[model samples]
Target: MREPYARYLQLLGFDQTPHGVEGLRQLVRRHVIRVPFENISKLLLIRRERRGRPTTLNEYLDGLERHDLGGTCYTSNPFFAELLRELGYDADLLGCDMTRVNVHTAMRVRVDGSAYHVDVGYGGPFYEPLLLTDSPHEMRQGPYRYVLDRARDGRLAMNVFTGEERVHGYLVNEIPREREFFTSIILDSFRPAATFMTQLCVFRYFEDHAVQLQNNVAVHYRAGESGETRISSMKEIREIFENQLRLPRCPVEKAIKTLEQLTGQDFFAMGEGDLYV
Candidate 1:
């Protein structure tokens, strides 16, 4: 049988035929760079018409192919796991306690008798897979260096430092999980009170740079350079999503309206290119 993602690899800008361990790494790199980590469905109030059934794998693929969008941890992990399995890999889904209270999903893969943690939805912290081990290991890509260590609770903690701040870290358990484990949290994320419903966030990671848009602020950081941020107007936000983030234009207005509802700002009243940060 043909792999589900065999055709889409070209869409992600790959021409070489990849196989084995290197193939796994290449697949992850292409995915993280091309498919942004975003929650446009929650922002736009779009829900799958499952009629009380759990979301299916086909639904996740449709979201990516038809909508030109990526999803939160729940959707992204399941989708990625399926792609990996279809391509022939020993892959499983793992849940992490991002805040030690909320669960985040990632992939654990065993390739060539070695275990690795592959996380495409992590946005920036992980641009590549890290060796899955109890001992500390560092992987540096571009300007950021990520450290992976085992926490006292026996979970792998992925940490990264930006300047004086320990900017990002999350704890992932070694145990594998299934989609049913994240069902409730996935539902909660779309609720009105959930942060996903109110905030506007989009992140795109590349080999040397990354762009993040949170609420009305946009930041672009490059290797060996200080990050720069600016307050974005509704128009500017749309432009960034379309041109910079490489997302479809259809969801821009809905996302902007959602941000307006969250911040109570009249973006039209603001001056163009005004400094926000």
Candidate 2:
């Protein structure tokens, strides 16, 4: 394996030896908690060039090292699948429909002849490799619960819920797709009105809690507790990114500036109603 990628696996707290399914679980779990799901790079790229580029794997890993940042499905999932392959795992790249047309990337690993669904992006739908079974399987992590079901289209459907309310539905495509297939969507996400570019959405999932930052508001919560949401200052926001989220210092500063330009609000004087989760 390459040095930087090897060091990245170690950064996620893995040993020098290859771990089987257990290692995959550890990688999936730690990747989310350590690398934030944010679009600061896209935001920065668009801010300067008014367009996007193909997000390369090295760029994604370098962002994690240089800026402590994470990319969307396009960057995160493909890199993860590559990591698994480099480490000698049978990993299959998969794509899904999160929106009507937009695609979300994930992967499936056939370990010991059993296939498991693995997603290290789009937050914490699967902190572990979920057994690909026709029967419904529900897994809970921190404050949220997700139900996995096989759809009629031969894909897997992951239903995200909090308590009794269904929050989101993701339908995994039955047919697997390659990483390069998602290049267009990656560029599309950086368009002026795209969600990842315009919104300051940051998510970090842990075993104990999940933290989210949308626009200027930050929410931290766990299961059984009403999450706390408050309008945050630039200083406080930086602290959250660096401390709570474990992101590097530089990119976050740039992210703040880009956000101010996008929202036309002063973070220093912002109030509660200025943002949302």
Candidate 3:
């Protein structure tokens, strides 16, 4: 294996290279727990460089090693697909639809004799791959439930439910896409109206629980219960990021300061609402 790739495996806590369906599951599980879904690095890059773009594979690996930073779908999913390919898995980078067309990215890997939807960047509680089949696959982690089913249009839909209420979802397109296909869309995400550019959001998922922070609100979901707390200050935000999410303190602080300067408001005073990831 290449040196950086070897280091990446070490960061994921793997002693030997993984293969097959069970190995794929273990890889996915370890990945999502170790890396997080956060926009802090993105925000910092955009602020310093005055532009938006996708992170290169080496840059992504470096960020994880240096700052405990993982990116949004645009960065995390594509690089992860590349890593899977390097490990000899038949992985394809696929596009998906949220409120807009081809706005989100995911992966489809053919492991063993079956195909599976593997998403480690969605900032959700997906600890393993969701098998792609005609039957709906349901998974419950903490207080949230996820169902992956085929829609009438032949597209796969992943729906998230919290206490019988369908809160969020996306439709996956099976066609594979080249990296250049998402360049413009990724650039557009740095626009003033985009969600991440407007607010501060970070998510970390574990096997049994998940933690999320959006602006002034922090929410956590544990075994059978979940709760939300309103953050009152930047100090509180720093505590949550450093202590709970295990993110580096310098980048978190810099991102918070940049967000306040960009939006002209106290970062911790904004109201929390549903963020379309």
Candidate 4:
């Protein structure tokens, strides 16, 4: 394996390169548990550089090593697909639609003659690959239940439900997308009107539960129950990042400061609804 890819595997806690379906499952599970899905790094970069772009493999790995940083879908999924290809899996970058067209990125990997939907970047707990087939595939993590099924238009729909309510969803386009296709969308995300630029949101998944921070509110979900706590200050936010997520202190402080400067409001005082598109 190449040096960077080797380091990626090491960070994911793998002793060797994984192979086949079970290997793919292990990779996906380990990745979501270890690497979070957050836009804090993006916020810092946009403040420093005055522009937003996806991270290169080296930059992504470096951020993880230095700051415990993981990125949004644009950075996480494409780089993960690249790693899968480096490991000799037939993985393709796929586009997803929420409120807009091709606004999200995911992966489709063919492992031992079966195609599986693998996404580590949705800021949700996707603990395993969802097999792409005519039949619906379902899994539950914490208080949320995820269902992947074919839509009437032949596209796959990934839906997240809490109890009887469908809270989140996206339509997946099976057509293979080149990396360049998402450059414009990724850049657009840094715009002032974009959701991530306007509010604070972060997610971290564990084996039994997941933690989500949207603006001033933090929700901890596990199995049949969830608890909510209101954050009153940036210091509280930093505590959550350090204590719950185990992120490094320097980048967390830098990211929070940049967020306040960019949005012109206290990070914890902002309103909610940043978690969904």
lDDT of each: 0.67, 0.72, 0.83, 0.84
Q: How many steric clashes between backbone atoms does each model show?
A: 0, 1, 0, 0
| Minimal lDDT window, size 10, model 4 | 245-254
Candidate 2 vs candidate 4: which has greater TM-score?
4
Write out the backbone clash pairs for model 2: 143-223
* Candidate 4 lDDT (Cα, 0 to 1): 0.84
Query: Per-residue lDDT for 212 in model 2?
Result: 72
Any residue pairs clashing in model 3, and if so which? none
- Model 4 spans > 4 angstroms off: 141-143
Model 3, 87-179: lDDT tens digits are: 999999999998898898889999888999988888877788888764598877556788889888989998888789887788998889987
Best by lDDT: 4
- TM-scores vs. true structure, each candidate: 0.81, 0.86, 0.94, 0.94
Query: After superposing candidate 2, which stretches have Cα over 4 Å from the reference?
Result: 141-144, 162-165, 248-250, 263-277
- What lDDT would candidate 3 get against the real structure? 0.83
